[model samples]
Target: MDDTEPVRAEDGCRLWTDDTGHGKPLILCHGGPGLWDMFGAVATVLSARMRVIRWDQRGCGRSERREAEDRELAVLQWSADFADPATARGYAEQLADPWFGINYECNAAITAEERQVWRETELVTACRGLAVPTLIVDGAQDIRPRWAVDSLQEALPSATRVVLPHAGHVPWLEAPDEFRTAVVNFLCPA
Candidate 1:
């Protein structure tokens, strides 16, 4: 599984996927809700001890959705104004140009429902019965508020949190070596 593979879903979306190494399955979810898989370097490091399954989420990266789907998303979600006019214009152009393949609707549709469910249900409480070693890595300057990360740390069992001080949402891009070191140390501590 050294090469990139395209997988077709039942709904006609073709996801670009890749797999490497051979150990416990580690599914790496890309950070940007709409961005592609940008974890190749991290994959190289972690593959030493784990089977890394990285894939571009639907309607992003190499997984292009149909024109109709893209149009629908643009119409439903691209009605808001952005902070910067140039940025807004650029993104608006990208939305109209089917090449960017951004799934605006899907990205905008995600709510705090998942987190709310985790908090409201017995899932967090039931986690008391589990004993899994978890490594939570986040950028200190991430758009996700500190309280959100703290809440996750509090909810999970045996979880260690690492915040890359100089990074934003994508720590690997901001601090590659540090990101690699932290992940390697966590997965294969010596």
Candidate 2:
């Protein structure tokens, strides 16, 4: 796992991937389904001690597009990638044309045959073990359901939650001044 390799998926999509460094495996899945392996900076920092594996998902970057059959199954996740409708237009305008594809970032979760494995992974238990100060800045108008955020707030006992009244998911883009002030205040309290 020291060099980049060209791999082919069972569905026949050609993938470009690589594995480097040593120690715990850290797979940095990019955000958008359309986004490619543009995490060089992140890999550079983590590769010092981590075994980082990166790949361009199907139909993105250098990977070949999915076959017709697989494309049918991919339609839903591809469409639901950005559930926030309010920011969809603005976000699309910000992106270039080559960045639209199926991001299989959560393939394990989405394509798993059994739910018990994921269910048994107690994320809350892991979060409870944290010993450092934590801040969760959320938007009051975020597309993500409130219950989801509430669950995280409940799980993280030491995390302070800041909900900007008029902001959405990308609060910095929506309200830069307020977002900056909140972050600065939290990071460098007076």
Candidate 3:
């Protein structure tokens, strides 16, 4: 946080929750389906304005790492990339399977066969059913040529998308003030 030190969670989840001002229940899902123990200063600022709920999506940081297969099923983890938002896209395509030719920002080295089967995964379905007033934030620069943020917004109708320019991968980390402003706007939305 920009003001205070890191606050650890005791639920075996490496999440930091605080009732900043009793506003909307804002659950901050950082980017990177693989990152857990990181947050940008922007959250620290937003912490003052609303009830901020941020968590490590279960693989990165303190969350116990899962089997490679199970990890692949963790679609919620993708939202953790707030710390490393990107403007470009297509990370999964290049490294993706030749069949579907799916490229992702974070593509773990798997056999070509694995890539083919991975495309049929129901991970997105699980992610789609998440019951939360979620806000998907992304960096202006993503590895995939076409940013997943738009697709994410369309898929998750309840979720809104926010893109920060001059910020890649992690908006809060790259441009603290701008990220903070966005967070405030999303939280306040006046």
Best candidate per lDDT, number? 1
1-190: candidate 2 lDDT, tens digit per residue = 4768879887666898877889999987766656799987887788889899988877677777654424543443333333356654554444323445455567666667446544524777877778677888877877678888888777787888888887766666666688888889889999
Q: What are the models' TM-scores?
A: 0.43, 0.47, 0.35
Candidate 2 wrongly placed segments (more than 4 Å): 1-88, 95-101, 105-121
> Which portions of model 3 miss their true places by more than 4 Å?
1-121, 188-190
lDDT of 3 by residue, 109-159 (tens): 555656766553364675678767677767776444444566666656478
Best by TM-score: 2
The per-residue C-alpha lDDT of model 1 at residue 149 equals 79
Computed on alpha carbons, the lDDT of every model, listed in order, comes to 0.72, 0.70, 0.54
Q: Give me the displacement of residue 30 in model 1, in angstroms.
A: 34
lDDT of 2: 0.70
Error of 2 at 157 (Å): 2.0
| Backbone atom clashes (below 3 Å) for every candidate | 0, 1, 37
